[model samples]
Target: MSDEQDIQARAARGWRLWLVFLLLVLIGLAISGKMLTLNMQEQAFLKRQGDARILRTAVIPAHRGVISDRNGQPLSVSAPVSTVWMNPQEFDLQNASIDRLASLLGSDRAALLSKVSRFRAKQFLYLKRQMTPAQAVQIEALDIPGVYVDREYKRFYPAAEVATHLVGFTNVDGKGQEGVELAFDDWLQGVPGKKLVMRDLLGRTVKHIRELEPMSQGQDLQLSIDLRLQYLAYRELKAAVQAHKADSAAMVVLDAHTGEVLAMVNQPSYNPNDRSNLGAGMESLRNRAVTDTFEPGSTMKPLTVAAALMSGKYQLDSVIDTSPGYIRVKGKTIRDHRNYGELDIGRIITKSSNVGVTKLALSMHEDAVRNTMQNVGLGQVPGTGFPGEQAGVLPYHAKNRLVERATMSYGYGLAVTPLQLAQAYIPFATGGLTRPVSLLKLERPEPATRVMPEAIANQVLRMMETVTQQGGTGRRAAIEGYQVAGKTGTAHKVGSSGYEDDKYVAVFAGVAPVENPEIIAVVMVDNPKGQEYYGGEVAAPVFSRVVGGALRMLNVAPDNWKPATQVVMQ
Candidate 1:
């Protein structure tokens, strides 16, 4: 509009433009300086904030120990497994995602959704535990948010039900639950470790930074059981139980010299691996040999005879009159199977004479029979370290009642576990030395305590030797090529009212190769329902087969081999 005025205005506008450009340059320079300060001075703080979102301290699982039998056979072991978990707070619980996860885990869709929704505030929740690696892979393929997989160990029992009662089982978290597993849990458990790791937004580990603590593995254990003998004993005992239609059964085989349990087994067992039926009942989980107790019955006769001998009132040649087949003590009559006019101590034991043994008890000090029983580990724990081992009832009556003494002398008025009964007979097997029972393998025999005089033990052992000979009660216990010394027992089970006439516990206990004793076995059949319920019929045969096999398996030289008849072909 006006050249001169426009010129002045243009000059002012140019100056204003130049001033604005300079101010813009200063602002840019100031911003660049602040950024440089942050990069060099506050870099560590920013890095820490970034790491808090993606870095994590991850757990390194430790491996559990192996359990083995004395022969180095694995009874229980551990295997690698995967556990799938999720951060419920970060999870997107969409219908599609829930359906897919539930289907993959074999879980109900409604239950899975409700569980996630209920614990939405939780940081960690298990989706499925102890899954296979293949299963974990399928889950990870879903690529769902907040899901994670962790490596862990799951217990696997290789011996299955056969060794379950001895080796026991563990929980999903690798904690021992029963038997030797529970008894030695701490020794078999491992200490887990930790490490610094970086993870992605999807809860997957990207990198391991450094280890915080090293994992400590558990120590292995070896039990005293010989698997071979265990299998043999189990097979034979199971057969006997089923054949007899018995309520239950238990058997134990021990090294007579060392007192180490070679084999221990019970009926109505369960598989530790397949625990689907664990909630059914605890009946099958019991170790009857160590946990159950029964009246020892006539099995107590040998010990009673030993008591009489120890009292210096009876000898190997001593005679007792068992006339009229029975005797009365305080209105309680004790009777023999039949009358045997008069018999020596040896014949008394051979025939298992209740009246003879009762006379022996009536004549000695009242405490004599009870003292002999307690001295040989009765009325006390067997010291086997097994969980739930019972100290069976050995009744003590201070009134010195004749009925009590007479009944107690012939193996009544007291209770004993099958294991305790096995241990009690050890003194007779080892010349009166009572070696401590062991459940763990030993390099050598343990020291023994003298429970009775050596001479008395040998004399009693000789008397027992006749029991397995012709016309003796335990004749069925005799082996083809070995001498056996043992006793038979048949006792009526005590009921709520009185001794039950319908229920009977048949038992047989014996030592083989009697000249130089090697193995001792005890067989007990509870409540046999078959026609024959006596110890000689139901239990002695099992002892014979088991001991006969064991003696041959150990290459023990037979002490009673007879000359084979040579017949010429005519």
Candidate 2:
């Protein structure tokens, strides 16, 4: 009986051990199945979590357009530059590596720390902009947390001060500020693009995923400016301003047929490349040729003569006695330089006689005189679309007393820009057609307005030609190998106390190769202090050099080559 009971106990113990082993195996298989199911279901969620930390949308910068001269010489351009930035929230300012980064970037440790601290809650900040590539490399080598580098463009002016006022400049944000840059900002500015990029812990881009948008670069602008002529005009105008010790000066050169601005320059100019002077004042930044207006002085005499011809009241041979040399109207005296004696209407313009012009103005209806001035573009913008262009002052002729009308005849009581003065003489060169002045390149000459009858325009042009002849006001304006026609002006500079006794504004306007004119130039020298202040003496020489060089440059045929070459005794 004892043996049988022992066997039974042993069998039961064996069975219990086997049962426990089977239960363990079944639990292991159930856990394995659950693990497989969870792995398959959570794969996408895990991927999203990992990507949130490394994936980023990055900006792909676009480049600004280039500005070139008519000959395709570059005036303004953008060059690639590197900028150093940081993620303020991720940056560890207290790290030992922070000092190394500041030294490599040439930044102050305290300043960098303060800047980071100020924007600690923010994710992005610019530490340095427009850094050199070598400096950027040194910064990357430091490998500070959250430090980054980006490629950007900086505006560069190749022409510098040569085209400063016209080409203008851009700001830190690459927005146009002044000049052509400001005028065509919409066309010159670029559109930036975006892309998905994979970045590392240090904010460096490791891989590019896909481009979200394509970048569009700004279109290039080809202006009508001739760089060669621009340099020439700038040099001459600068020299004249210095030699004469004048306050300032301006010059404008136009294509006689197209009315395109070939060259425009001013004195006291500043470099567009260096903006330090901008803090001083904007006086040097002004394009005086277009922005500032001045009394045209005797340059208006040609317009007066043209109007007189248009009215049919005065023939080219019509004679008037200017023997007294002076006349009085409205308690004011209008005088001539000398007794011009009894002279033909043509001689009146050749001499630039104020008394003669006064007589003509008084004879015509006031409205006619006013209409002529207005028709010629006085008191109207030159339509160049330049910033700060002044339309000048033109009072109603009907309201003007006799004296005021007389002053308007000789280019007083009104104001005009150097550009307008240049534009006004276009009819003389274009046979009564007045073309709008253009700074942009035109494919073809546009149709012009008929400001005066063609016959009357030609007759007035003939009379103006004599002004460059012997015994005329603008003899110095005569160019070699060309038939020059122009008027001279020397007006007392108006001061706070009315016209000053010693100061004068010398001005000269004319068309060259008069037989078939091809160039029209206007020059104004303000407050010339030399012994000679007359327009012929002070301003005519500049007109001669510029217009003469321009004609030769264009290879225009000579109209009076023989006489022009001959030396005339002054």
Best-matching candidate per TM-score = 1
Q: Please write out the lDDT profile of model 2 over residues 1-570, one tens digit for every residue.
A: 699999999999999999999888888988887777767987688789889899988889899999999889999999888899988877876788787787776877897898899999998899888887878888887878888999889899998888888888998778998889998899999999999999998878899999999999998988888888888888888998898999999999999899999888998888887778666667788989898888989999888887787777988789889879998888898888889899888889988889998888889878777787788787898777777777878788664588788899998888888999999999999899998888888899877999999888888888888888898888999988789988888888889999899999999999988899888899999999888889998889899998888888878889996753668799
| Model 1: ten consecutive residues of lowest lDDT | 92-101
The true-structure Cα RMSD of candidate 2 reads: 4.2
**Candidate 2: segments with Cα more than 4 A from true spot:** 1-44, 95-100, 103-106, 563-570
What TM-score would each prediction reach against the true structure? 0.95, 0.91
Decoy 1 TM-score against native: 0.95
Clashing pairs in 1: none
Worst 10 residues of 2 by lDDT: 273-282
- Give RMSD to native, each candidate: 2.0, 4.2
lDDT of 1 by residue, 1-570 (tens): 799999999999999999999999999999999899889998999899999999999999988889999989999888999999999988887735678788879897899889999999999999999999999988888888888999999999987877777778988899988899998999999999999999998888889999999999999999988888888888889999999999999999999999999999999788898888967678989899999999989999999999999999877788999999999887877888999879999999899999999999888887899999999999999987788999998987664688988888778889999999999999998999998889899999888999999999988888888998997999999999998999999999999999999999999988887899988889999999999999999999999998899998889998989989999999
